[model samples]
Target: MSMPTLSAQEISSGRVVLRKAHDADRSGIIELFTDPVVRTYLGGPRPRRDVESHLDTSGIENATAKPGSYVIARNGTDRLIGTLMLARRPADRPGHVTDDRDELELSYTLRREEWGAGLAFEAAMAALRAAAAELPDQPILVVTQTANQRSLALSDRLGFRHVCVFEEFGAQQSLSVARLHSFAS
Candidate 1:
């Protein structure tokens, strides 16, 4: 059978909803890559013109084109606040929990204004729970830059244990792991 997945699934929780990107999310998705604070650990913000150059309505939904890709928005509205992804760690990427396979990786980013309200954590938990409920039991990974204390703290709060440190994107990074089964009800 094909692997169980969150591919194109619309998931929601009390405060956040993880849904496919849409036309209304274009500006928010652009802001995610162009805003300085939001892209601080993500190779710094791309030039706004450069970021805007490649996007069109079709490109917005490109964020959710694959299984596990989602635009994080408020529960009752389409306004985008952030992005969350529960997908494979590319084999070419530095961090991996398994030798022969690309492990599921959790990555997220939120609008700076929404940072202190626990929205990132809320969005992540919602995605993780959804993935765990559908996918096979396996190790999920969280790789964050060492300088990003906020992300590392969030990983801890989500129950991932630090595994190692490695260099990526010109900086030291930390890798952590949590089993998929742990999130299942």
Candidate 2:
């Protein structure tokens, strides 16, 4: 079976905009991933050399072409402060709102400097709106480390309720869901 493709979408929420990653965002995304504190809950920060090399290859174009993957920019600037990803959860994965493999999974990461400024929530809310518009009736799932209080709180504020908590990647992972609306189409 072939994978379905999602149409690219752009959303704006005041000074923050959710749009596709551009070539200019390549360096910023690399910087976002390489920050030690930013990657703490994530596996870990990748080596600068490795990240740079990946960007030099196919990272930018691939990211841009994929739908539901966005670079969060501020004030219409090319400087990306974070990223949002909405993807289908792998059927093999532990968390699932249903038996379907196409459930939408929401993930995001922002620069440390943007922390406590509510930028992550802004960007994510925009992405959620777009997801609701495109994939209505389908629930959005956010999986994060339970120990990451900020992320957990953000998920809660975004109206995502805890579905379950389990250990994954040697850390406690919280699987949350938000069923914003139902699409009748």
Candidate 3:
């Protein structure tokens, strides 16, 4: 299904709201990629200058132009604290649940300050439930570095069972999946 049908209100629940990103979010967006704490398991933080350069070229305004990319924000504010993205896992990537590649993938990252509050869990659950309700039953994958115990735990909390572990990015990466139908309303 297309992204247009999924509105910010649809994925929003309780204290958190997931909405498309914008230029006003430049610093927050940059922080997600540059903050050492947030990027520890994601290949480390990129240089801030390079990140700014890329964002300038791509235009943060164009980010939400695609489907399933959201800024994780508090319910009463527009300030962005993190990002939750659902996108196609390219066929050429190291992980896959089906013989065919390009399965739906869920990835999220929150600012350091938001850790331990269960905000990531809350935002992710809301987004996945929304996706499950709107899309057909299929395997949705969550691939994370095996060394990331927190992420592995979160995957389990989200009902994804580990299927296999493979080498990627010079480290062992675990692939887990949850059936989309199981989450449908």
- Report the number of the highest-lDDT candidate: 1
Q: Looking at model 2, report the run of 10 residues with the lowest lDDT sum.
A: 1-10
Off by over 4 Å in 1: 1-4
Q: What C-alpha lDDT do the candidate models reach, one value each?
A: 0.86, 0.79, 0.84
Query: Root-mean-square deviation of each candidate, in angstroms?
Result: 1.8, 2.6, 2.3
Model 3 CA deviation exceeding 4 Å by range: 1-10
In model 1, the Cα lDDT at residue 87 comes to 80
Q: Tens-digit lDDT track for model 3 on 1-185?
A: 22232344336788888987778899998998999988999999999999999889999966566678788988888688888888788788889977778688989998998888888899988888888788777788999999998889888998999999999989999999998777765
- The reply for model 2, stretches above 4 Å from the true place, is 1-6, 182-185
**Model 3 residue pairs with clashes:** none
Q: What is the TM-score of each predicted model, taking all chains together?
A: 0.94, 0.90, 0.92
Best model number under TM-score: 1
lDDT of 1 by residue, 7-107 (tens): 64688898999988887887888889998888889899998887677775347667788888898999876679999988887788898877755788899
Between candidates 1 and 3, name the one with more favorable TM-score.
1
Question: Which scores better on lDDT, 2 or 3?
Answer: 3
Local lDDT at 16 for model 2: 89
Candidate 1 total steric clashes: 0
